[model samples]
Target: MPTKTKSKIKITNKKVVQKKNLKEEVDVRTPDGGGWLYSDIVKDHFFNPRNFMQYGEEEKFKFNGIGRVGSPACGDEMVLWVQIDPKTEKISQCRWRTFGCGSAIASTSALSEMIVENSGMKIDEALKLKPQNILERLGGLPNRKVHCSVLGDKALQSAINDFFRNTAQHSRVQTAGAKVIDKELNVTDHDIEEAVLEGAQNLEDLQHKLKVGVFNKEVIPQLEDLLRFYNEKYYG
Candidate 1:
């Protein structure tokens, strides 16, 4: 008799995940209308934030500048300087010099903190997020500042692209680890790592985890735990 071979199974039409470590109370569609615009974290950081402000010629960071956005055309000039961690492929430092309103200043400031906190996130994932996402976490942003919200997204992307163009080799690894967000499409290595760590049996499990949201440390384990608990409770 001939020995039979086992057929391996595969997952199909898996839901794509975008943006990582999003806020649970995210209201993308309705978005805060006339309530507290930002969260305490934004307020705390915007007030003081991490590290020093106002980079100069003799500053320690000495940003060579990976990317710069805006000009007199947009009524502002934004410049981003990124310092990558040699080993972790993480953003060790993010500094932006922008000339605009408080929204511009506040939004950029909040963005720096987010990048530092979520070092594992990819540039795309980080770019996909709006300043309002940060503003919403704080008490709130003035309506006029809404425009500045997207600036953070654009500026970060420009900086990321600069990182890719200027230094493409290792950045590939960083690009691979971005988070999934609502309405996001691109996938990277970070996604695979997160999914595997989450113990996601299928794409559906990963998508569900994205809906609820994630954080820095428990990026994968949190999803995995949910899957096990959910399966035992529902599928069991």
Candidate 2:
């Protein structure tokens, strides 16, 4: 009878799984078991959030531009409001509200500070601010939490777009690679693609998701065609 040979198991340092509770919320700044997930600045910002909106204070803020993103149903939502100096066109003041996790609060808090820093950032300069810049200033978030850092800039850009539209400065609106589909609402193919991917399947569903053709009934056909193309490409 042949002797049975046992297979040897090999383990590498990088593949080592730390024995710890995955359910517990570890300190992001200090490593508990999962290692440092956030930097010192992120910790400070999360603990002492700045320019955050308090309850019943929504009406008190006098803002010229407003931007909102995310949804509470998805477990994260952020709203950013800005006051632009008429003379300087700089972000005079910025306030925010976030209904999400620690990272979300910290990112928005950091953004508010950066915006109002140096006597407020210029609108054009502020619009150029990207997620990478915010992440770099915070000393970088963990790979999984990186998406949280994007919320601040997205909201800020949306607010800027609102400001441009409100001031009749349509030339300043940054489409971010989106081609305009409806001139009235500034609805773009990118917006429609995003809405469809987010689960808006029909004309009514798309309207509910993006308000794309709500006002301009004439654009319904074009909107529908794009929606169908995307749905087929992605889902079919």
Best by lDDT: 2
Clashes counted in candidate 2 amount to 0
lDDT of 1 by residue, 131-193 (tens): 657665444555555654436666666566445534533234234235433212232333333
lDDT of 2 by residue, 1-236 (tens): 56577547655568665443423433455445654566678889999999998888888988888877776655678889999886799999989989888788888999999999999999889988988777766766666666654599888987887687668776677788668988877877766765665688899998885566777899999998998997886677
Could you tell me which 10 consecutive residues in candidate 2 have the lowest summed lDDT? 18-27
Regions of candidate 2 where Cα sits further than 4 Å from its true position: 1-36, 189-217, 222-236
Model 1 CA lDDT for position 28: 28
**lDDT at 38, model 2:** 66
Error of 2 at 191 (Å): 6.4
- Overall lDDT per candidate, in order of appearance: 0.52, 0.79
Name the weakest run of 10 consecutive residues (lDDT summed) in model 1.
181-190
